[model samples]
Target: MHRNHELYEYLMKNSWQMTEDWYKQVDDPDPNSLYSTTDEHIINTLKEQNQDYFKRLHKIFIEQEEVFLKEFEEWTIELAKDQKHLDTAVHYVVREFNKTQEVYISYLQKFYKENQDKVKLEQFFLWLEIVRKTFQLSIYIYMEEAQKNTSKQIAAQKEMINELSSPVIMLQNNVGLLPLIGDIDTARAKLILENTLTQCASLDVQYLCIDLSGVAIIDTMVAHEIFQLINALKLLGITSTLSGIRPEIAQTAIQLGLDFNSVRTTASLANSLAAFNQ
Candidate 1:
């Protein structure tokens, strides 16, 4: 139900040729990129994907624009999420997209030249606009999905780091050590609370020695979170002993009116360990 049926058929029939032509021109010197891969299987698969992409692109000339775009976007999103493409630098992938668009435009021009008597210059320009817009939409969708996947991976990595940073290492039967170091932001404090509780419960720790010797600063909110963690552990029947509480931290706790009298305290990790291990 399209006026450009002849052009659509022409492109569909030559999809493979377009893919081959596109790949032959690929000249990326970057050794880290999939574009420069020497693997035969990957090269073949890349050509297949490119051909499939062109086939879908040509459908826009024949199918309803809405239908074509919805299908095309799905393909682009899946390609964006592909590990090979994700591992490759984004700029390289986008450059390939630009090159592919040029292939389509070149093919369209060829078609126009062969049918100059039937295809007006204005009609050719209109088709060129459609080609450019479709490529733009595809690129936008790909970049958006790629960013979302990258963000998800980063968040997962950050969670892992938070978990590792707040580890509760078992030193003896029913005893564990949580060495607090560096800055304790509110976010990290909350993570510490959750991770500590889970680790303590899993390790069946009865006494947890929280060493704060390396920590140089603690804000009011973070200090509150630490207290909450202590109380939470208390509810779990785990006794928490504060060790190496720095002078500045103690001063902050005093200013905030925090009651550390309820929990046992030690001047250093060694003293706490000796007391708990005894």
Candidate 2:
């Protein structure tokens, strides 16, 4: 009975609960204790009395094992996923460190005694230093990569803002320069107009120059936008000059019949600046 109590306590600590029959099975009569039944007979009676409890305990044990196995499998999968990048970094570090270790070992073997004890401590210290240095180097490489990625992202964001803002590049005090680059869609054209107008008002410039050397061709929508820009600039009391008229663009503008009669035109940026100076 005492042994049964201890076992029950141990089982409860390990998250195993028993049925009511458990107590009845361990408290039966025994002939060995100067009673009517024999000890074996008492034990057999207990087993018979608690058959259902034993069966339930067996089922619980099986379920607990299954639960532990499932959790272990899940943990393994998560660890595998998390370690992929770390594993690559470790591989790189190990490969580079091994090469350094080989060179150092070769150099040491030539000067040191050949016995294991003679160089074991020195080799251990050397390997420890190599590991420390390798860890530092790996950290440095990771930091460098992170910095480069951050720089690229910042640069991209700035460029996007500049593009959306349609920043006007002022060339000289007299010349209000707007160097058109890349494809100029209708939205971009509107941005260009707004930026130009803001710059013209702030600078109080008399001549506004539009350089189209970077532009490939003129479409109808872009041509109309250009015409609108000319009108908007005229209302702001600033004269707008067009430059870098590629022959293909000029031909396209003519085919589209984009009305540019009110705006002055030039062949090159240099020519426009020259005309402004005069």
Candidate 3:
């Protein structure tokens, strides 16, 4: 009890110098790291944030574990959301975080040496436990935030790829051409249906030339979904023409009792478009 109070007082007195030294040690002015930014205002803000963290960390020794954890969680949540840390690798921050543990350990060891009678052996173990728990929470928050950010990025990229792959070219006024050039998985097929309908409506395409020249194969479910798109366009007062149906794919559709009699189809995209408005 007495050792805790004395150590708290000693830490409070040395907090400013400790914070400054810690900042100096971790400071990476290489312009690559989020903290060691070149901008004067950014550098100052990072320094302030670093100092605040050190102050709060030292207070953990004096405060209740629950209270400190609540505050630390809040601080780290902000750190996780910060664009600076998001731009940098978590491993970089991990390296810097390790330095802090080393620095504080050195401080604890020095305190133990000078006041051997005042500091109990239990205090060292207890302090290590607190540091370990706090870092565990920090690591969890960083990983969770990074994972969420990566998921969002991947979703955005997928959406972009869907849009690019299923392009509706304005081959003529009131006429559009959607050329499916790659493998049509179930997901991409669904995207094609949605994008086709949306683009047809938004672009005011009276007729859509769906060219499947690039597609070598498709499943029955995929062929059904595509025909469903055609049916949908028909209800919308729009005409849809299927072109460049590969022999194997057409046979698969026929074998599945799929009929193209209800919809117009051509052997080639050029022939389909050439027959447009004639």
Candidate 4:
């Protein structure tokens, strides 16, 4: 209806005022939340962001639904990736979003009340539905983007942990020590193989001693990967020494018919070090 444009203009004028009112009414108790931030700069940024959201929301009255939603999604993604928002609890963010939607609905109700006779009841209901639907869509988009950002951060952390866990400690000239611990899954074994080869080359190490005293268990696939690493090291012209081959692991190697003739074997890490010094 023609009144749609009138309502849009009305909301547009009150955009910054709405932000101020909503912020004043915000009652966040959690100190960890973005809403609870006391920094003047952060508060100003939050207000600006809220005003920006209102600007985008009001555009629905004039813009095509598809176009509006696309721009809304862009705004959602930017807010979702914001470090401050990311640091805040997701539930708190959603709570604030719902609160903001309530504020918008109240404003719409006020506008409808002011022109109760001119705007039909059905038109008022339609406008309310649009506001609610748009807010719901924004929330859905925000959650998805936040989840994706979290996944990427976790993957990066895992990579750092993997690199740290599989360190190739340089012992002396052209020699390094790799002490593996805990269970060796196929995935970790593969990481070790790749990481070790790269480190050996970078450090210009001609010899590597791999100690397995801390390793409690390894599956068949992991054992195969370890052997594959040794073979890889051979191709790189690096000699490899295996130490602390637990009886269980030794049995697995024998059962698998693994050929250990190509690499040096030692009873313990100390023995390997002694051999290296000889």
For all candidates, what are the clash counts?
Answer: 0, 1, 0, 0
For 1-278, candidate 1 gives per-residue lDDT tens digits of 23499998999889999999999999988999999998999999999999999998988888887888889999999998998998888899999999999998999999999999999998999999888998999889999999999888889998998888889999887899999888888999999999999999999999999999989888788878988999999999998888999998899888888778877899999999999888
lDDT of 3 by residue, 1-278 (tens): 32276776777777667666766786665567776666788767766776677777777777887788889878877777777777777777777677766666677777778888766778777777776777777678767877687678779999999889998888676889999998898888989999988988888899889999999888877887898889988988988899999998888877888777887899998899988857
> Relative to the unseen true structure, what is the C-alpha lDDT of residue 253 in candidate 2, on a scale of 0 to 100?
76
Cα TM-score per model: 0.90, 0.42, 0.78, 0.90
Candidate number of the best lDDT: 1
Give the range of the ten consecutive residues with the poorest summed lDDT in model 1: 1-10
lDDT by residue for model 4 over 121-234, one digit each (tens)?
A: 999999888888888988998899999998898899888988889999998867899999887788889999999999999999888999998887776788779889999999
lDDT of all predictions: 0.91, 0.56, 0.79, 0.88
True-vs-predicted CA distance for residue 269, candidate 1, Å: 1.9
Off by over 4 Å in 1: 246-259
lDDT of 2: 0.56
Evaluated at residue 239, the lDDT of candidate 1 is 88
* Candidate 3 local lDDT, residue 192: 92
